[model samples]
Target: MTRLSAAFALALALALAACGGQPASEQGHADEHAAAGDHAEEAGGHSEEERHADGGGEHTDEQPSTTIPADVAERAGIEVQPVGPGTIADEHEVQGLLTPIEGRVAQVTARFPGPIHALRANVGDTVRAGQPLATIESNLSLSNYTVSSPIDGVVTARNASLGGLADEGAPLFEIADLSRLWVDLHIFGADAQHIRAGVPVTVTRMSDGKTVETVLERVLPGMATASQSTVARATIDNADGLWRPGSAVKARITVEQQPVELMVPLSALQTMNGEEVVFVRVGEAYQAQPVEVGQRDGQRVEILSGLNEGDQVVVEESYLIKADIEKEGASHEH
Candidate 1:
């Protein structure tokens, strides 16, 4: 009986050895895994090649165009604007204050140290060129010297009173024309780079948001001590007496500008995979189209290529378009 059992066990062991170590189901699973690995390697290589061809290389700045459904874009507040003839004024919005033009302001001062003999032009008094602001009895010369207004203006400040002592070049009164003024705008960093003489600027009063057109006269070569920003000076005609000096205001200084046949708002521009992109409406899908951008102002950007007149472009909240395109790509990879 023991020999018969031993023979049966030996026969079973020999049969298992003939079929290999694993069951048929297990063997099948192993074979399937190996096939899958080979297929994955093949697919990964193909995807890499496609990506490189489609401008997906690490140093490549061009991005492959993608698309999003029209309905989805609309729900995401992706506003579209038609590309057509428009003026793109490369402008910057900056804070400014109305200032009196230098030649229009007169700081009436005595040439020598003296005592004020008489005060003629008080604050709020209008005076003309050579009009006496005060008569000073000089301490050195001991003669009464007439300190007169150097320009036709109204006296805005009076520091010397009747019988007051005055030092040489001590301002007795300040006279300002107030007819012509300047918008002293402080622009920092890149905004100050292009600002120079002859650029058109618009000065808006901060009190009531009143706007007046003007041209930038010149940019101060030095920066302000307190603000650390360069000052851009624009001369504004104040003949109407509406614009006042020393008042806070806002200015739109056009730095660079060009008229273009087609343009889009700055908000419409998006960077995708190191390339500038804008979503354009096509049929029922919004195509994330790579674009060649040109002279861009503060508000709009010139579309040099990849778009045409009357083509609708996504202007607002375009990140949703980018996200949807990326999601679709990930799904296809799986």
Candidate 2:
């Protein structure tokens, strides 16, 4: 009885111990799965936080940058210059006509009215003073009439012909001194005061395209009765016979004087806000400077202020530069 009872009791105890260890192994496996899930969630949240803090680094590096367009700069065509001093002359241009300086117009007349016998001088013929122009045979008995030139010049007009009646005070020929000529200038009433004797003058003839330089010789005391304007005379040397009488011309008279001022070419100046301005080059850029102007000749202009001597200036194509600067300023405003 003792041996069989011991064997049965040992087997029952072993079976009960095996059944108790099964629940503990399943609980340890469930705890391991929950811990793995928590660790995975924490790691995913930390990765997302880092990405947000970095602000999408690769995309931020790819943002676009601003730059000046080459086409705009090309169209602008900007130019720059500096300030300087130069000579400037103020002159006035007036219209005029040419005339003989020293000459005599004579009319041929016969003591006894008769017909022309022969002709010596014709129109446009050069003759010396006192040279015979024409001869006439009178109807009166034993009479001969001879017409002569009164000055050394070209014969501008002639009316004597063969067998033509010779009458008193009849114009046979007109002679003019071709060596020297005069220009009759008409000045307005207000400008009359500016013109005087001995003022320098330059005359340009329209027909032959010649320019003659001279000085004002005389000014008529009274104004012209027809035009109510004063008349000024300028004498010119014409030894080359380039000038002719009765030719229309243009005369420039220097009037005002402005001594020793900073000057620049007329092309160097530009108008800005109703004031004259110039672009001064400065270190790969340009600065606009306002300037005051005084007297001006044909090509140069007097600078009254806002400039110094020995400053480099742009003479050619300055207007184009001004336009570019204005366009750039407008673009900045927009």
What are the lDDT scores of the predictions, listed in order? 0.76, 0.66
Model 1: per-residue Cα lDDT over 128-217, one tens digit each: 988877888999989998888898888999999888899898888999998888789999998777778898888889899899898888
Top TM-score prediction, candidate number: 2
| Candidate 2 local lDDT, 107-159, one digit each (tens) | 44455667888899888888987788888777776477677776677887787
TM-score of each: 0.49, 0.64
Cα distance off (Å), candidate 1, residue 75: 29
Clashes of each: 0, 0
Candidate 1 is scored at a TM of 0.49
Span of 10 residues, lowest total lDDT, candidate 2? 59-68
Candidate 1 global lDDT: 0.76
What TM-score does candidate 2 get on C-alpha atoms? 0.64
The C-alpha local distance difference test score for the whole of candidate 2 amounts to 0.66
